[model samples]
Target: MPPRSDSDNVGFLVADVTRLLRAEMDRRITAAGLELNPGDARTLSHAARCGSVRQNLLAERIGVEAMTVSSSLDRLEVLGLIERQADSVDRRAKLVHVTQAGEAMLESMQPLAAGLGAEAAKGIAPADWQRFLDTLKHVRANLTAARDQLRKENAAA
Candidate 1:
């Protein structure tokens, strides 16, 4: 095969990094007795940060489909880790808020997760570290823009 393009190489690198990071996070969280599947943990974390996000917005923020978010929320609510409340402004819309139990779990998981992130970035020069962050942000923005464009086109169609 011809030499890979920059985009191809970057795609492979991103996949590799994502897998490694996810594995590490899963190990740490499992060790802490969280027992959360990746999706549940991610949803809970988002709820923790956003206070109470609209169901659709929470799905978008976590990069999952609305149905997936709803299912995850169902499990979380059943486990007493989250609660859904009617949005006063839009009675039709529901908001997801983490329960006290969820907050405590998130707080307990913070130190291990934060330390893992720090260790992962260790030894990089400050300038290079900054650039790495910027590049990742740029990639995410590009993907988000592309996704939005596609959504608009689909709606038009």
Candidate 2:
């Protein structure tokens, strides 16, 4: 069996792609005159997608620190783009929801995002793109399951 180089490793390739994509997205967002920075934009997007998620959970979903999400939420609330309401089940916890303004902002950014996606897929055929996405999803599922198993084992130790 031959050892794989960094460029040929799945993890390295995925990380490189993710880093490049995020950098490019940030650049485009800035060039488009969007008021939000990449981190805030990402937080809002995830919050909107999750629909009334807890602050901590939203942070976990977005792979950011709780304080980072908290700061973004503060700015978003000030802009009237999102609101937080007391959770019925846990008074100490708040659930974040995107306001109408937030939805409007997301809609405005849709074309920018779609254009970037098209650019990234320029050399790939539609079928190949779909297959690539499917494979990525499968890989994500496998990794998630393994992570869950590790957490359980750690908790039991």
lDDT of each: 0.87, 0.92
Model 2: clashing residue pairs?
none
Counting clashing residue pairs in each candidate, in order, gives 0, 0
What are the per-residue Cα lDDT tens digits for candidate 1 across 1-157? Answer: 8975675588788988888987898788777777677678888988888887899999988888999999999999988999999999999999888889988878888998888878888999888988999999998999989999999999999
Model 1 whole-model lDDT (C-alpha atoms)? 0.87
TM-score of 1: 0.74
Most accurate candidate by lDDT: 2
Task: Please give the RMSD of candidate 2 to the true structure.
Answer: 2.5
Query: Candidate 2 on 54-138: residue-level lDDT in tens?
Result: 9999999999899999999999999899999999999999999999999998998788889889999999999999999999999
Candidate 1: which stretches are off by over 4 Å? 1-8, 35-38, 49-51, 56-68, 87-93
